[model samples]
Every structure is written in C-alpha cells, then in structure tokens.
Target: MSSHPTSPRPVADLFAADGRLVAIPRRPARREALLAHLAETLFASGRVYREAEVNEALKTVHEDYPALRRYLVVGGFLARTKDGAAYHRQRTAPLPGGATPSVA
Candidate 1:
C-alpha cells in the first residue's frame, strides 16, 4: 500500500475533520465507496500478496483486518486465488445494471 492516495473526490467526505478514518460505512453505496478507496491504499496493481501480507497491510488501517479484507474481495476490489493463499487488486467490475461498483 502506498503511504498516501491521490485525492479522489469521494475520499474527501470519508475522512474525519482530524484526518482519521471515522468508520467504514455500512450502507452498500457508501461502503463500496470507502472500500474502493481502501483498496487503492492497500494494494498496488499487478502486485500479489500472501494472506499474511494482506492482513498486515490491512491492520495498519483498522483493527478488524479480517472484515476489511472480506469487504475488499466481496466488493470486487480485490481477488483471491482458489487456494486462498494469494490476493491481488482487480479491476472493478460493473454491476448488473452496468454501473461500476467501485465508487472512485
């Protein structure tokens, strides 16, 4: 993960006034937005990570690394091998109605 992410507009609203993560939203629309931003911060394109590596990276952001990792995969921002040993950033796929799932 890069130390900083280039500011995408939606990220402006996700951070608290003191520049800490307030919380990851629960609503699908808002959560997807936050997850997409998080995906960018945690994974680089063309990079593959072992499960431990992924968890360590996520731990830097939140205590609930497991949940964060799950959301990144389920939200379509990351992918894992069938064996579940490796993970990578994936291109965000469009939803059923042709809307891109990643908010950024």
Candidate 2:
C-alpha cells in the first residue's frame, strides 16, 4: 500500500521560512505529511508527554497548540493515553518510493 494518505501535496509547501507552521493542509495526505514531520522532530518516539508538555512543544511551532496537538493525534503521528494525559509519537511508516516527507 502507498504511504500517502490521500492528497499528496509537496511536503515543502506546508511550512514558512521561519520554521513555523504556515497551514495545516485540508487534504489527508498533505496533513499526514505535516504531522509526521512534527511528530518526528518535536517529540521523540519513545518519550511520553504530559498535556502541558505537548502544548508547549506544539506552541514552539504554532500559536494554535491545542489544534496542532489534536491534529497530531488524529493524523496518527501521535498517540495519547486512554485518559488523555500523555502522548508519544507512533511508529512512522515508510513513505512511498522511500521518500521521507519533511517540512523543509
């Protein structure tokens, strides 16, 4: 199966020059690409985060921390605890053609 979710936009288009999030794409593929980069770069795969920690890390990228956190979970780049207390990066599936998407 292809690693792309749906609408595979170029990964470089998702960010601004300042390393901040410019937009979260509407398409599933583009959104997943963004989330993957965020998850890989912002949070360590085996590390757990409290809600505040997650918010703080996300805030480093965008002002809308809560929305970004939610998108991370929803997009499967992050996984949260049953009580919503902690989060960690999920395993990243390899991309199609062996191309790993990045925000840059």
Candidate 3:
C-alpha cells in the first residue's frame, strides 16, 4: 500500500471555494508542496515579518494560523529568528528527509 493519499490531487484543490485551505495534507510530499506554495504566495523574500505579521498573513488563508506557522517553520519553508520575533521565506526548503530541493 502506498503511503500517499488515496488520490493525489493538485495543490489548488486543497483550497475551498472562498480560497481558504480546506485541510492541510498529511502526506509529506503534499504538505511540502502546500507549504512551498504558501511561502511563495504569501511572503516576500528578504522581507522580515514580525510574529503578528506572520499570523495575519496566514490568517488570510486559514483560521488556524498557528498550525500553519508551525508547519512552515518545521518544514523549513520559513526561517525564524532565535527569538521567534521575525520570519522570512526560505529560498529553498529542505524536504522531509533533510534534502534540499534542487534549483533548475
């Protein structure tokens, strides 16, 4: 049996009609893809965001901003300061096994 979701769907299908995410994927590959997309669309590179700013930006997509924030940080999609006061999108995030995605 495959570890992936029963049917692999496009990253876009995870969002609801109102544009908020319906659910966060449990599969590593899917979750990684979602995180990458969120980081790219919601954050600007080289721009530092306060914790409140991160929450607000995430809230635009889902009510559970904390969960999203945690996932982004844990997945290496967003890097935060030692104090967790600021965050910035990472250029290349590491995959589930600590492997960084290769740039084209």
lDDT of 1 by residue, 15-59 (tens): 777655667777787788888888888789778889999999887
Candidate 2: which stretches are off by over 4 Å? 1-9, 94-104
* lDDT (10s digit) by residue, model 3, range 1-104: 76866776789999999999998888899899899999999998778889999999999999989999999999988888888888888878345778543222
- Evaluated against the true structure, the overall lDDT of model 1 is 0.78
Tens-place lDDT per residue, model 2, 15-40, is: 79987878777777667778888888
Measured by TM-score, the strongest candidate is: 3
Worst 10 residues of 2 by lDDT: 95-104
Task: Arrange candidates, best TM-score first.
Answer: 3, 2, 1
Clashing pairs in model 1, backbone N/Cα/C closer than 3 A: none
Residue 93 accuracy (lDDT) in model 2 = 69
**Candidate 3 ranges with C-alpha deviation above 4 Å:** 1-8, 93-104
Best by lDDT: 3
Comparing 1 with 2 on TM-score, the higher-scoring candidate is 2
Q: After superposition, how far is residue 34 of candidate 1 from its true place, in Å?
A: 0.9
